[model samples]
Target: MSTYHIPVMLKECLEGLDIKPNGIYVDVTFGGGGHTRAILEKLDGGMLYAFDQDADAKANAEEFQQHRSFTFVESNFRFLKRQLRFHGVKQVDGILADLGVSSHQLDEGSRGFSTRFDGELDMRMDQGAAVTAKHVVNEYEQKDLIHILSAYGEVKNAKTLAAAIIRARGMKTIHRNEQLREIALTCAPRGREMKYLAQLFQAIRIEVNDEMGALHEFLEQTPEVLAPGGRLVVMSYHSLEDRPVKNFINAGNIRGKQEKDFYGNIIRPLESITRKPIIAGEEELERNNRARSAKLRVAERVQSK
Candidate 1:
């Protein structure tokens, strides 16, 4: 099959997983199956389960239907534990999650994920999802928009931009991506217009899909889903996504707060395999600019206490 997305840091992610040929594995974000196909190549009697909610991803998985060792789950990774249990899988040997928008999603303008494209304001990772960018931009209260911009995007002038959105939508409902872009352009800083626009779109996308909320739920289930000595390899494109993954591996929670037992031992389900996130090599950067922001973190499930 043709390439859909060039998997970022492919070698590093494979090394991080420390794949066992006979082990059970999962690729939670099987966008174009770049990583999934690689993992499948290394498997013998092992089974690999891939998860994605996007309709396009489901279609991409069709080729693997005949592969005895592969299974494609048509659901979000947030339901990780429940889905695994339903499939009669108590635990898996390794889990790989690449939390980034797929190349196809952005390239398809009707998906409304790119700033350069003009399409309807619909940015749901899962098309079936109720909320969309249109709902967020037009229906959210001014204060809520300000909070989403500041917290999710880290946009500096969140209040001003939120006010602008409120005013623009007040005149007419913002139905298209271009309409919202123009409103944000008016509030964007002179030299950083593109960056500001990207941040603004990122904030709305995150809210529309409940990305952070799904991430927290998924992370909480990793420990229970992983077998002892199993690896959890994750690649995140932004700090917002990386922080929780780092904290959960180190502290057993998304908050990064360590809890102590009666004997003063810090309790956590996974042990950090990498103290710092691994970045893509210079060669990979020259080949694919999207790999520039990618950060890979690895952790292992600790033996039962």
Candidate 2:
């Protein structure tokens, strides 16, 4: 499990959940089962439902299947509410989502999740998914590409990058990571080639997986699925992912809009547990560089007054 991917801020995530010995819980992003394994340990009579869309992640979860309390849901976390209902689990004590691509995904060149590796342009988290990064790079319109690059990846030269991709693909389909990388390099800034490439790749990957859309859908369902006072512990890797998590926790909506009651009391489903997000300690950071960009926020489900 450790080799598959180290669970970033493992201790912090556990603490944030405030685990109860016999309470039901869910691990929404069961990549590598690192977090799921830890959560299972804390359960005595409690049930733990682990969800993942990746085929590799399901294989990693096989080790825990024999355990009486563990149930692996082979689906995207975006279908959280419906899946829980199917399992007769209307509400849960806690839901922990470790967002973004796993270390295993990035290290495997064939997955095309890493800019460092030259491989197929496929970046589908669900291997069976219809869309791939190759499709997005070769088929998406220039304006659409620009929007994803700018909004999802925060790429500084989105317009130039999109135009370059459009021009290159017009001559031939962009079918591999290297092909797209070369086109992106043409538009990259002088000294920030690596960063620019990463942003470009991130944008494509996000669109291929519909990451932002899935995230918004998943966040909207959390309040409905979590039992009152239940914890919503999420660790996001980038601002694009982190912003919505932060907003949902603080304002009860993804837009960060706070609806109030007639008396002016905030009408929200969750309350932020900490004033700021929790960061990994130096010890953890040195051991795991992935934790460097991670921002963890914990919020408890609350009923409106």
Candidate 3:
């Protein structure tokens, strides 16, 4: 599993969870099950439930099927609450979500996640998803492309890039990663072609997976799914993901603005445990490059009065 993905900030994530020996836990993005395995080791009578929409992840989880303490759900974390209910789990002691593309997905060229590859533009994290990167690139209107690029990728010249894509697709359908990369290069800044291309791909991938929407749904359910005092540990790769997470933790909602009650008391579902998001230390960064972009935030469910 280490080769598949050397779970970023493993030590920090564990410490953030502050695992209890008998606490029920959920690893929302199971990936290679590295964090899930670590959680299992700390539990004596506790149970660990893992969720992943990717079929490959479900296959990876087969390794733990014999362990009565572990259960894997073949679904996205967006359905966190409903899935838990199906399993007879009303609440959990802790939940951990690593909101980054898995190493396996990026390294596998056919998955169409990396600019370094020239595979089909099919970046659906869940292959079963209706939309794919190809659809976003070829079928989306120019204005929609601009929005996705600007909002999801933070591209500086999204409008120009969108025009380029529109023109390119008109000549011939953009079906491959290299094909889209070529179109993006025309609008890329002179010296930062690689960065520009990466941003373009990131935008399409986010749209294909509806990453932000799913994140919001999963977060909305966290306050209800977590037992009082239970931890919510999330590691996000980009600002698109981290910003909402930060807001939800600090303000108890994605809007990042406090909602007050009739008595002027703030209504919040969780309290931020870390004053700021935790980044990988020099040691972890040296061991795993993926750790460089990781931002981990910890929160505890606020008890109702």
Best by lDDT: 1
Ranking by lDDT: 1, 3, 2
TM-score of each: 0.98, 0.98, 0.98
User: Taking the tens digit of each residue's C-alpha lDDT, what string does model 1 give over 1-305?
Assistant: 35578899999999999999999999999999999999999999999999999999999999999999999999899999998898999999999999999877777779899888899999998999899999999899999999999999999999999999999988999999899889999999999999998899899999999999999999999999999999999999999999999999899999999999999989998999999999999999999898999999999999886
Error of 3 at 240 (Å): 0.9
Candidate 1 lDDT (Cα, whole model)? Answer: 0.94
Candidate 2 regions exceeding 4 Å error are: 303-305
For model 2, how does the per-residue alpha-carbon lDDT over 101-159 read when each residue is reduced to its tens digit? Answer: 88888888899988888889999999999999988988888899989999988998889
Q: Which residue pairs clash within candidate 2?
A: none
Q: Rate the local accuracy (lDDT) of all candidates.
A: 0.94, 0.91, 0.92
Candidate 3 off by > 4 Å: none
Model 1 lDDT-worst window of ten:
1-10
- Candidate 2 at residue 61, lDDT? 85
